[model samples]
Structures are given as structure tokens and as C-alpha cells.
Target: MSIGASITVVAVGAILSFATHVHSSGFSVIAMGGVLMVVGIVALCLQIAALHRQRQMTAAEVQPPERTVVVRPPSEY
Candidate 1:
């Protein structure tokens, strides 16, 4: 997920975990929200790592190539 989406997920998770009070027999909303928040954090970390790698690759590709020239002594005057 993109950064924005990840942030949204975390926000929604936070709201669910803290803003509401719902009790169900099957599962806990707070726990679900915590899981979602963790997922969002993981996504965000992965995205950042991917972008960093891409930038490094781009920087490597953008560098100018080195050139070398050799001069030989003029043949017998």
C-alpha cells in the first residue's frame, strides 16, 4: 500500500481501538484494530525500503560514465 493508504489504515485502526465500545462474542474490535495498525506500519516500512532502493538504483544509473584517453609517442620524426 502507498504511504497515504497506510496512514489511513493506521488512523482507522486507532479510531476503532480507542473511540468505540463494541462487545462481540466472536472477536474483539480493539484487537482487530491493533492488528490493522501493525499491518499498516509494516506496509509503510516496506514502502520506504522499496523507495530507498529505487532511489539508489536511479542515482547509480544517473552518474556519467568515465572516459579514458591514451596518448602514444609520435612515430619516428
Candidate 2:
């Protein structure tokens, strides 16, 4: 996932975990939120690592300009 999406997921998870009080017999909202937060954090880390690797590859691909030699003809007397 993208960084923005990851962050949004984390934010939503935090809100669900802390901002509301709802009890359900089927599933736990807090647990779901916590899982979302963990997933978001892992995705964010992976995205960052991928970006960093891409940057390094890009930097490595760049090469300096090639040098050229110029020759002069002998001057006529």
C-alpha cells in the first residue's frame, strides 16, 4: 500500500480502537482495529524499504558524461 493509504488505515484503526465504545457478541472492534494498525505499520515499512531500494538503484544507474577528444590540424605556413 502507499504511504498515505497506510497512514489513513492507521488513523482509522486508532479511532476504532480508542474513540468509540461498542460491544458486540460476534467480534471485537478493538481487536480488529489493532490488527489494522499492525498491518498498516508493516505495509508502511515495506513501502519505505521499497522506495529506498528504488532510489539506490536509480542513483547507481546514473553515469557521468563521456569525455571527448579534439584534434587540431597543423597550421599552414
Candidate 1: 10-residue stretch with minimal lDDT: 68-77
Give candidate 2 regions above 4 Å deviation: 65-77
Q: Which clashing pairs does model 1 show? A: none
Candidate 1 per-residue C-alpha lDDT over 1-77 given as tens digits, one digit per residue, 9 for 90 to 100: 89999999999999989998999999999999999899999999999999999999999999889988699988996
lDDT of 2 by residue, 1-77 (tens): 89999999999899989987999999999988999899999999999999999999988889667898799999999
Worst 10 residues of 2 by lDDT: 60-69
Clashes of 2: 0
Cα lDDT listed for each candidate: 0.94, 0.92
Please give the RMSD to the true structure for each candidate, in Å. Answer: 6.5, 4.5
